[model samples]
Target: MTAPAPETEPTPPPGRRERKKQATREALLDAAFRLFASKGYEATTVEEIAEAVDVSTRTFFRYFASKEDVALTSQEEQFYAVLDAFRRRPPEESALTAMRHAGTLLIEALEVDGLADERMSRFDCLMRLTEESPALRAGSMERTRRKNDEMTRAIAERMGADPERDLRPRMFAAMASTAFMVAADAYRMGVCGFGSFSEAVDAAFEVLEKGFAEY
Candidate 1:
């Protein structure tokens, strides 16, 4: 089911005004991460993020509801893309195989977008914030569980299983989700025996997949 990455072209901006708004939004996202990285996520206030971008706190709220919201915005973008990628996987593949490929696309996309590097990435800041802040980590855990459930539905559809009656899809989805997270963390800690995060994730899935047969 795993195919090459999709190459969809981006649409041109509709007009100058919309482009300007988008620029502002992008600037805010970048500025927020920079501030969160430099000043500490808890210490960095919304006002600081707004002021860093030469905008009012009111304008900041216009773009993002809260600090946590801005912190998660980039992740939200990638999460949806992974879901879409899951739908593109070949149907003949088992749910676990399909998920192994689609799920790793999360890391693949990050690498392609030039955000997977430990250095020289705003996402690094976001990751650090999520790791350091108890509140952010709690929110992230709940968010991950919800997103995993969404993947569970996709897995059920691919496998032609009744989600209401079948528990296998959900279990497979949960395993894939945990595997990806563990792999990414291992890569971050330089213990995954891989150069790339995507490879780390693949290795994690491979090792995890071998477990049930042993027992």
Candidate 2:
């Protein structure tokens, strides 16, 4: 009699594998942020983050370069979410209107109890660190520049204009970026007496929609 063939392990579907990786990445980010918020970003070592997630340091590195990378994950996600929201807005809406609405939704999402969770609270701590750490601030600025370029192209698409040749899209993007920065800085500074970041964003967008005519 012929020997029975050996059984082979079946491969997981691509979608299942991708979801597993995403879950691991999210776990690392959660652990890193929790440690950073409690112990301070500068003091939280990659080893600790990995240990918190019950993974090796090498596994942490596979998901993120450093604590900063993990800390910024929420912000990175928000930026992309805003872009996606903008794309879904009615084509008839003006760029400024679409941007304002998108920004509003993003900030509002952060205020939701379950939706924001510990990840977002950690992001708040990271934002505070950025205010004091030059290194983190520089990294944030670079990311902002990239987001601006993306928004410029996106705006150009909405307007049916060439991003390279027509300055309108770039100009609008710059203005929107500045407006958001102003609101965020006010919230970070705690001088505006605003109840939430969403409130500040709403006020800033209102000003933009009005073309600063009141001023």
Count of clashes in candidate 2: 0
Model 1 lDDT tens row, 96-152: 666678767767776898867732265567778888999988887788778888888
lDDT of 2: 0.78
**lDDT tens readout by residue for model 2, 58-166:** 8888888876787776788888888887887778778888888877776676677545435446657777788877888888889888988999999999999998889
All models: lDDT? 0.78, 0.78
Off by over 4 Å in 2: 1-27, 38-42, 113-120, 131-134, 188-193
lDDT of 2 at 124: 70
